[model samples]
Target: MQKHIFNIHDVVLFMTVAECFLLVIFQAILPVKNQLANRLLSTFLISIAITSACILVLWNDDVSLFTAFDEYLLPYFLVIAQMLKGPLLLIYVIALTEDAFKLARRHLVHLIPAAVAVAWLALFQIDSTDLRFRTLGMTETERQIANGVWHFIKIMPFFYALAAVNRVRLYRIGLHNQYSNFSPTEPSWLNILTLGFLFTWSFSILVHVIANTVALAAPQISDLFGIAENYIIFILINALFVNSVVHTHKLLTTKPEAAKDKVDEKLTDTAIQKVQQGMEIQKLFLKQNLNIDEFSKRINLPVKEVSAVINKHYGTNFFEFMNSYRVEEAKRLLSDNQHADMTVMDVLLHAGFNSKSAFHRFFNRLVGMSPTEYRKQNMNKEVKIA
Candidate 1:
């Protein structure tokens, strides 16, 4: 009993369970919103949960824990989990590369075989004389039913191989079409998801094949091999949770100018109206804490359109325009003798500079001198007056 409690396998099993729960929570709260990556992520998380639960039931100490369900229920779960990985990966690739992802009604047909396998396994387990279950393990001659299920699920490698090649072809098409225009440091979250899932699933299938092949020769190594399945599920869940949350948050919290650049695709007929609106909008932007999106909306132009117009016609982007206004305000603050003792950063912050680096960069570019240099020039005048 003590050995069972301290088993390495049990530790891995619990960790896998914990990861699945956290993944579920992340899925519920931090959904991918409009992104297609979320669909793949959801499928992967569900697959991990199903896989982990199957393992847990297989390794459960007492048969009474699932007395109503026969031993064959375990293989059914494994088969379903195995079948899900390929389609999830294929869909992930589609979402990453394709702008439009409409799931055809026929995709559901892929699951029919797995469903049939599960139902057959269930029937055999109930009828003690069933050949497949008997061969899989319920009888005294074959005690390791779970290991047999692992062996049976290995057939999914064919599905994975087919999907992987198809994904590569689709990815090439995506490159020529939508993905060709994306800049390297731009938020390519779907690309990340596509590549990451494919790499992970490929490695997982390789490990499963190698482990099972070796186990056929040396049965003792089977326990060690079983451990990999649980570990893979744990890693996949953790990756999904961490990567999805980080990528989603980064995209959502991206700088306003950066977000604008992402949404601007073409020059259109409304360019004149946008430019005129931007000119009027520039005045209100001088106010501290002015929101770009709100200003754009108030002016009845899309934010990206307003940003593009300002960049093209006004000769400056939104950040530069806003910071220029702030810097002018800061210059006014500096000229006032009453606040002469304030630091450059303090003046900048009061005038809406979010960072000293930003203030320094903008000041040098626009004013042709550093803030400190300007202060020294003013000091020389003050000294001359004194």
Candidate 2:
């Protein structure tokens, strides 16, 4: 029996995997209200950890460890891990962005490719002993297949990453459109995380492309390329883990103060009614760049008292409360046939939104579509009615 040798690479990869595993475990044990989102994030972390482990094993070049496991199992596991990257990322993004996100039966469709890859590998293991041996030993043909599959895997995540970025983008937009002080509502960590994934994934793909092209001319350099690729993967994994830990810690540890008690103490029913009447009857929300202090002054209530009334009765901060009204007015203007000639910008400005991006974002959040789409749909409906 050959004793397994440990190297610096092995130590680093093990640490990376350990970090990811710890993150998943911590997230699972934490009694968060959004368990579904936490679970999806954990799943994403675990998938990456599994992929890192497989890469480390492959890099170690120790066949002795395979004695414990079936010959085909490792290769199948690696392929499945690669297949899962795209789907898991997409689902995780949805979990974060969608308030009512739940794993539906249709979501299983994303896992079909991984299931199919496992089935194909299983059949390969049974049908051809020579091919099984080739796969386990990483023969030239097997390596070529792997290279092709990796290219496909890299491409697959591009779409998912695009979707995730778009989701975050819209979420940010919604916040700005619905809140005067939207800075507090920003998910800076999530934005950073999504961008990091994109950058690392793209970097890996570029490295692979360059390595493969170079290998064609200098076949002997393939082993060196493989070593470099393994190191890059390890670094990428470590970077992502570190980034996640820092951001996640900030997210979990820093709890915003609930305004319930303040609202209960300072705000009266009569005051709440006065503020509501002022907002609705006077259309105070149409005042551009309105703040809590300004609104409070207008309603002749203390700032904290006004803020509490909005927070308690409206279930949103003063910023959000004001922006909701602006968004509603924007919607009405956009849908009206009289404003058919008006561009989105014109309507957004008229609706008291200084930022075009905020207008589009908030409109999409409230309507589940873009301002352009909403206008088009409404116009089409009117045309048909006529």
Candidate 3:
């Protein structure tokens, strides 16, 4: 029998596991209309909890307890649970971004990896006597095989993260094409989740490498890595809770038909010229809530072709192209004595922007200065010139 080595790290791991489950319940009862996303996210969070549970078992450091657990599938579930994190998160992104998204039988394909993981465990990974897989006693070939399997598990998140990021990019492109102004903050939740997934993947790899190296010399220090990972999980879980409260509902929209990038070399230079003329000469950009469809009809071009023309010629989506013109218009207004009495909010609103934060972000990105700074600098120059 092995004595349970209780430590402070156990407290953090327990809280993380408990919070994961708690968040799942909250998602289940969350009063949002996007129940599909809510449910999918809940399942994803539960899988996270399961992963945390497996680590919690390891943190327990009790071989007697492991022997008791090995009587059932509990030991195998640690590996099985890990195989689920990637698929669950990717599908949850689909559900979150697509309003009409329905879980189809085809999505069952994701389960194949989980089944394979189970088989891999049963075949190569189970050193049944000790109820653990990796050991100092493993042959060189056995260690390589085990490391290969774990590497495959670790890399799934990266592959899924790439696909998930592409889906989100298309979704945002769709929004920006149809809506003149994205508010209250350019889908910050989706942005956070995507960046968060990437950050978590990188951070885990860094921690794993350093911990394995340190473990070679001081084995006990390895426990600290588990503690750090659990803390990260806790923080992400709480971050998701915050995002759900503030940002989840914004995802319930369809991708516009022409939003997906398609190069059209044959879309005549004349057609591209027409879009530019409409924005520059007619000042069509000043129309509040301008959309590709409306501008396409006004220019007498198909929306798809118009989108292609912008993508091909200007190297920007409709959102950026329109905002560039709007930024120009705002600059003109800001530097002019004719509109000197107008506030920054007034100038942005009149320049076709709905959200002040969104306007400021675009302004800073395109003009390399905040509106106030740009205004003051130009106004001072006008003073000097006078």
- What lDDT would each prediction earn against the true structure? 0.58, 0.67, 0.73
Residue-level lDDT tens digits of model 1 in 1-386: 33444367667776776676676666767645545567566776677666666566555553224543335355656677867766676665555444456578877876775675576456445322232333443565343443444444555644654675566554443332221021222135444544555555556566566654785687566666567656765665665566566654343222212344533555565765654554445555445445556557657776667666656655665656666777787777776677889999788877776667767877888889988888778778878898
Residue 377 CA displacement from its true place in model 1, Å = 37
Question: Residue 58 lDDT in model 2?
Answer: 56
Which residue ranges in model 3 land beyond 4 Å of their true spot?
1-5, 59-72, 124-149, 165-179, 184-189, 203-216, 251-263, 273-284, 293-300, 331-341, 360-386
Compare candidates 1 and 2 on TM-score and give the better one: 2
Give all TM-scores, in the order shown. 0.51, 0.57, 0.78
- Model 3 scores a TM of 0.78
lDDT of 2 by residue, 221-244 (tens): 665555555566566556555544
Range of the 10 consecutive residues with the lowest summed lDDT in candidate 2: 249-258
In candidate 2, position 264 carries an lDDT of 60
**Model 1 lDDT vs. the true structure?**
0.58
The 10 consecutive residues of candidate 3 with the worst lDDT sum are: 125-134
The residue ranges of model 2 lying beyond 4 angstroms of the native Cα positions read 1-4, 68-70, 123-146, 184-186, 216-386
Which candidate ranks first by TM-score, i.e. highest? Answer: 3
